[model samples]
Target: MLKVECKKWNQSLEILREEALQAEHPRTRERLMALYEICGGTNATLVGKKTGRNPQTIRSGYIDTMNRV
Candidate 1:
């Protein structure tokens, strides 16, 4: 995951966050939140702890989301 500048990136997740909230599966939501947190200046390790996912999973998921979007 890239290092996020919080002030610059936090509010930019409106669309992604909405997609995350509307996701039906628990894993998908977790993946989306990992992306959200990463883009919000939260480190992947912390995001993993918060979301109960592995840090690598957070990073990979964020990258995957980025590729898709």
Candidate 2:
């Protein structure tokens, strides 16, 4: 399982999921969904395959979302 690495924030996966649902920008929402899957222990490569995001892009989105929270 991949652990969330942020020391300043410990947001629950559910909160990320909900935020993804509420995000105003389509791109932001899409990235947030990828971020949610990553936090749930889904492999970045698998999320990339399923969502059509590059693996590196998925990881980057995960990192960006973690910092935002």
Candidate 3:
């Protein structure tokens, strides 16, 4: 079970949503959407399915990058 500490990123779900929509790059939008959904209490499995990625990739890929940021 992974938790998205949105506060640590200085962003809210709304902020992530806006950024996702404003993002010019497809991959950037995808990543922001993932964070937005996860922060809004979506399951990684469902998000992954929506994004056509593996659940574990959803967990490890952006989550790991989010951690670094």
- List, residue by residue over 36-60, the lDDT tens digit for candidate 1: 7677678888988887777776666
Using TM-score, rank the candidates from best to worst: 3, 2, 1
| Tens digit per residue, CA lDDT, model 2, 1-69 | 344553456667887789899999998898778777877888888988998878777766566556666
lDDT over C-alpha atoms for residue 63 of model 1 = 55
- The lDDT values for all models are 0.68, 0.74, 0.89
Worst lDDT window (10 residues) for model 1? 1-10
Which prediction has the highest lDDT against the true structure?
A: 3
Clashing pairs in 2: none
Model 2 lDDT vs. the true structure? 0.74
Q: What range of 10 consecutive residues in model 2 has the weakest lDDT sum?
A: 1-10
Q: Is candidate 2 or candidate 3 better by TM-score?
A: 3
